[model samples]
Target chain A: MIARVVVVPRPQVADPQGITVARALAQLGFAEVRSVRVGKYLELELDGPPQDADRRIEEMCRKLLANPVIEDYHFSLEEATTQR
Target chain B: MIARVVVVPRPQVADPQGITVARALAQLGFAEVRSVRVGKYLELELDGPPQDADRRIEEMCRKLLANPVIEDYHFSLEEATTQR
Candidate 1:
């Protein structure tokens, strides 16, 4: 099974990296850029049945993959016959 | 307007970080994990109309936000009333 997780900074939190990048973009001539927030994307392939993937992913996020306080994670599952 | 860009390692690239992470997960008891890949997520808000955003974001990706060779980027555009 394949699981994809998208983790992003919480809307209310301060994102200094985003601010820095936004400033750079403005200097690079993208003056319309108002804001930028940076985050993480994770893709995982697993050896288990599709049924067990969601629960496992939730546990993974809670245990290690994501910071519960400052980030939010969402995941999607798909069955794959082989690794690409 | 808002643009969310997802940048991920190309499938053909060697992702040593992912390998290391997967190994750590196995040691932490996630034995079902076959592989892991990590990437970047960027959220941007702009001051322009939706019509100009797509081309501008593509240029942003090409010129600064993403490396054309080892990484692939995809972005979504939406109209936003205000920053949250």
Candidate 2:
């Protein structure tokens, strides 16, 4: 199974990194650029059936993969669909 | 523009967290699971023309959004395609 996870700042949170990048983009001639929010993307593959994968992964995310207080995480579970 | 970035453990890196999740999935009856790799995914929205957006965002990624030695990042620039 493969899991693609994304951890992003909640909309209300302050994202200084994103703001800083946005400023740089403007300086680099991307004058129309408005905002930039940085976040994390993760993909995991495990040998398993789908039945309980979501629940387990959700738990894993909350416990260590993501910080619930400031971030929001999302993921997808599937059979290995593509080869790298 | 929305840039979706993913930061993943290098293929050669040992990801103990991925391993732990894989074990849990197996225990939860995802018996067919084989291996799992975890990575990051980010979406950024910047109002801009397409011409210089990529280069600027790429730079932002390397400087702060991603750690090149241990991870890889990817993103896209487009007019807000889907509203969330």
Candidate 3:
């Protein structure tokens, strides 16, 4: 199975990287751009039954992939179609 | 308008960060995890007509959000429901 995970800073948290990117865009003349937020996208290939995968992925996110105090994470799973 | 952009390293590119994450997961007992790839997710808030937004976003991606030599980027636009 393939797990697609996204980890993003909580809305209330300040994101310096996002602020920098927004400023850069403005300087580059993309004046319409008002704000930006940056996050992490991860794709994990796993060899496991569907039933166990969900639980394992959740555990992985909490323990490693996401900083629960300041970030939020979500993921979805799909069957792998090709070998890696 | 809001644009959600995803930027990922090309498949042939080396991803040491992903390798480290995979190794950490393995050590932490997530042995089913076969491989991992890490990428970036960005959300941009824009103030513009829907018609012009797509072209501008494409230009932004080509000029800034993605590295043409090592990364691939794609984005989707949506109506903003709330102010940032």
Best by DockQ: 3
Which tens-of-lDDT digit does each residue in B1-84 have in candidate 1? 989899888999888878887988898899999899998889998897788999999999999899989999999998896566
What is the docking quality class of candidate 1? high
Q: What is the iRMS for every candidate structure?
A: 0.9, 3.4, 0.6
CA shift of A77, model 3, Å? 1.1
lDDT of 2 by residue, B1-84 (tens): 666666778889888877886787577655655776766555667665667678867876787667899877677666676655
Give the CAPRI rating of model 2: acceptable
Candidates, ranked, TM-score: 3, 1, 2
Ranking by lDDT: 3, 1, 2
Q: Flag regions of model 2 displaced more than 4 Å.
A: A81-84, B13-40, B50-71, B81-84
Point out the higher-scoring one by lDDT: 1 or 2.
1
Best lDDT among the predictions, by candidate number: 3
Stretches of candidate 3 above 4 Å error? none
Instruction: State the weakest 10-residue window (summed lDDT) of model 1 chain A.
Output: A75-84
Highest TM-score model number: 3
Question: Which lDDT value does model 3 have at A84?
Answer: 62
Model 2 DockQ vs. reference: 0.47
